[model samples]
Target: MYASFFGLSQDPFSIAPDPRYLFMSERHREALAHLLYGLGGGGGFVLLTGEIGTGKTTVCRCFLEQIPADCNVAYIFNPKLTVGELLQSVCDEFGIPHGHNGPGEETAKDCIDPLNAFLLRTHAAGQHNVLIIDEAQNLSADVLEQLRLLTNLETNERKLLQIILIGQPELRTLLARPELEQLAQRVIARFHLDALSLAETEHYIAHRLAIGGRHGALPFDRAALQLVHRMTHGVPRRINLLCGRALLGAYATGQSVVDRKIVAKAGTEVFGDLPAARSAGHPKAVAAGLGLVAGVALLAGLGWAMGVKLPWTGASPTAASSAAGPHIAAARPAASQASAALAATATAAATDHFADLFTTLPRAEDAAWRALAADWKATPDAAADPCEALPAQGLQCFRSTRTSLALIRQLDRPGLLTLTDAQGRPAYALLRGLDARNATLLVNGQPRAVPLATLALYWRGEYATLWRTPPLDDRLKGEKARAAATAQWVSQQLATLPGVATPASGAAAGDSPRERIYRFQLAQGLVPDGQAGPITLMLLNRATGVAEPQLQK
Candidate 1:
């Protein structure tokens, strides 16, 4: 009804999996990349999951349209089937004549025999057979195990069948069950689809309207778009539902342009009355609510309890958006739950993720101080605050937030990064060392060597790095020219600090004090390649207490 009034040929915001209406946001495009990569791989399961309405079906349909000609795909939309029924459905989708006997009887054995034969023939013909199961979270454990057995049917080079399992986030949890460890191992690629961002949401609405034959300007105004994003949380299906209703409301009210009020009024009908909608108008109330939540979260030994959803910090804006960098989008499938938890910790520590905003507490994240502490033989205090306890141990902790790779590399010293677990309890990691190819992260005092690319997946542009120097003066930030003085100062301090290894005699015999500085760099977790720039001096200043000692905020 609204379409005709707005001069559109069709309904633009219909929540149907229409290929023509598909809007591939950056996150969705990365999702497609993972699926397509699976098809080109040595044949294993490809997993795609998201919260409901993240366009898994749209991506899958898109994948199907682009499937290779030599590949035969059997797409299973509903996976709530018994093991026998699932096998039969696969045979039906593939047009494989199975479960028939010479006596004109059908049995499970009959089904298996013909299916295996069909797979062998397909492989002989130099073709690939892929089985894609959607809503796979509903599959029974025994049935999932059966699917795993099916994957075992293989040739010398690869399996006879490649599978793609698509479902909601629960599927990831389901697979994590100890019983499904084998099946989980077979998932060579996995991606979690996130909601659209505010910018992408605008593009999505426009793309759908254009596809629906809107030739001129957009019907919904800017305010309308913003409200729609807030109300729908940039979820595609929710956006569609709300937009469609908003258009209807505008048409009913005899207004041509959909505005903020139209969306606000329509939201009542679509999602029902809620306290959250008032959040925009009453920030103080929301803040109070947030405080209550934070108290509860902290008491419950949880961090996310601070809010229903994690706040988009300067560095941790809805991770995987265009803001988080393209390399961060292809989420490295976590090696295990422990690794996954560590990634979460990394994100929460990215306090400087916001473009213009900086972390209020600068001295809480210095990786240099953490590194110096690590080199010292003292066990980090559990009973005493690290800042206070370390000082008693003849050391001081200082922190700073860095926003980019260059800024971090500029500091050129060991730094402590804050990590938050799923519950939101913040943890800390010492970035012991890094190079072009890898990073040495000290998680819980255990050294974890992670690929540079893998670490980027969780690095949200903010990490707490430590410095042992007195507080940094803004003018001295990039002061690279004074290396000799700073190195000499640190060399003398090393002997006084307890358990610190003093440099070998003649270490400073060189004209430039190069070996002495290199020894100091190695002690402080700087990549000991022996080029002293501003980072070396800044760290050196921190080590000799040239800056004022400050406690963590």
Candidate 2:
């Protein structure tokens, strides 16, 4: 009902893992790095543990994006199976067909033979195999031992198959048992994923909003974000639930701007029970008093305008007709215009809304593109062959290498960067470079000094960079400058497309068009108030062809 009122293409705070809405926090990056390390390490077990709702699955999904084609990966999500069932499941995952026998020993041997043979073949081809077990805490000791046995099929150089155990914190406790000591000892690299910090929480919200087509500050006020952080403790799942509810609340009440008041109201409605001090008084009495005065004034005005006199006994038909005359005619045109405008608006909004929905970025799949771009930009010296330099920069540079890369750079500290490839190996080490006050990177044989502003932008998830070492004047002179100018011209060309219709909401009886617009703004991830501010204007301009007139410009 409130969606059209807020102008949102879809619900922004949905709890479902919409790849488009995935916000990668620093902690998440670290977790992914550790997983990549384990996968790339090529032997032994890699363990990942985290509290519930910390986005462990998301990290795993992100890791899956960079896995090499040569490397066979089996992701076993169900851990409740017995040893025989587990072996059978693994076989199924690897597409190794085997009949279900009567005995456990036969089942194990049947599955193991094909798996070992596959591993041997993969090893001969210089490829690795990985098995990712999610919710691994539930795996019984027997099942885990069966998994350990699969690692026994390794060659003298390194294990043919790698096992990754992902589970809640309880998995650590389970592994701590003396009986499981052998399995625990085999874990070469382990990382515990944690929730985001308060600052990261704020960034997470903004990141999701931006991905959802928001170009400016969204419906969430700073205080509201703080409250959400406090309540959710930076857990992505919890934050999503709370934010989603808050947006719904803001939309329902025709509130475009989601301030603390709206958030508080949403919190109470969703979570229940505000403190006595906060819940102080009701506004119903004041509203009733205002309504009474307005009603009396309306009646008096009608009586005078229609020259109708109300008798002490009853209202005469003649008097009633005189009073209703202007109202009936006034209502007809107003109602018709309102209906026509609403239909037009809804039809327009629905078209643009669907476009936004379909155009969303797929989470994890784009990791390669992002990684390749970053690697290319960072390695100017390797630029002699941009294609070749691409992979070294953290991308799959060549099809021949059979390598995949995933790299994450920290914004707060430029020197703190981690790059990992398909086998989960660290391809580049730049931990020290980010610490320097003025850092220089060689990309495609071109040396460029990195500016603080450029670093800041990258940290904020912006793709491009502004080079500091070689002055801008030197690089952009003549043809380069003309190319840059032409790029701007292309942007103008793209901007000329037809405007998209804004999303609409089911309006309340008393709602004005501006009120509906405000709701639409909130839904679209803009501040909820009905006014079209700069942020809303930008989104509108981007979605639609109509350029909002800039008063300042």
Highest TM-score: which candidate?
2
Tens-place lDDT per residue, model 1, 184-261, is 988876889999888678768766876787644466766778889988888999999989887765443334456555
In angstroms, the error of model 1 at 105 is 7.7
Which ranges of candidate 2 are over 4 A from the true structure? 100-106, 268-553
Q: lDDT tens string, model 2, 1-553?
A: 2333344556666778777766666566566656665655547789899989899988888789877688789889999998888888888898877764674456567888888887888789877788999999999998988887787887886788889999999999999999888888788767788888876787677656545544323556566777777767788887777677666544332234455554554555455544521432244432332333234335644654687542211222223223445442232244433443454355346434423322232233233333334532454343244444443333222121211011112211112122322244332212223322223433333333443222222233222211111112334559768556534433443334322122223222453435444433433433244554433444444444442211110
Give the clash count for each candidate. Answer: 32, 42
Q: Who wins the lDDT comparison?
A: 1
What local lDDT does model 2 show for residue 242? 69
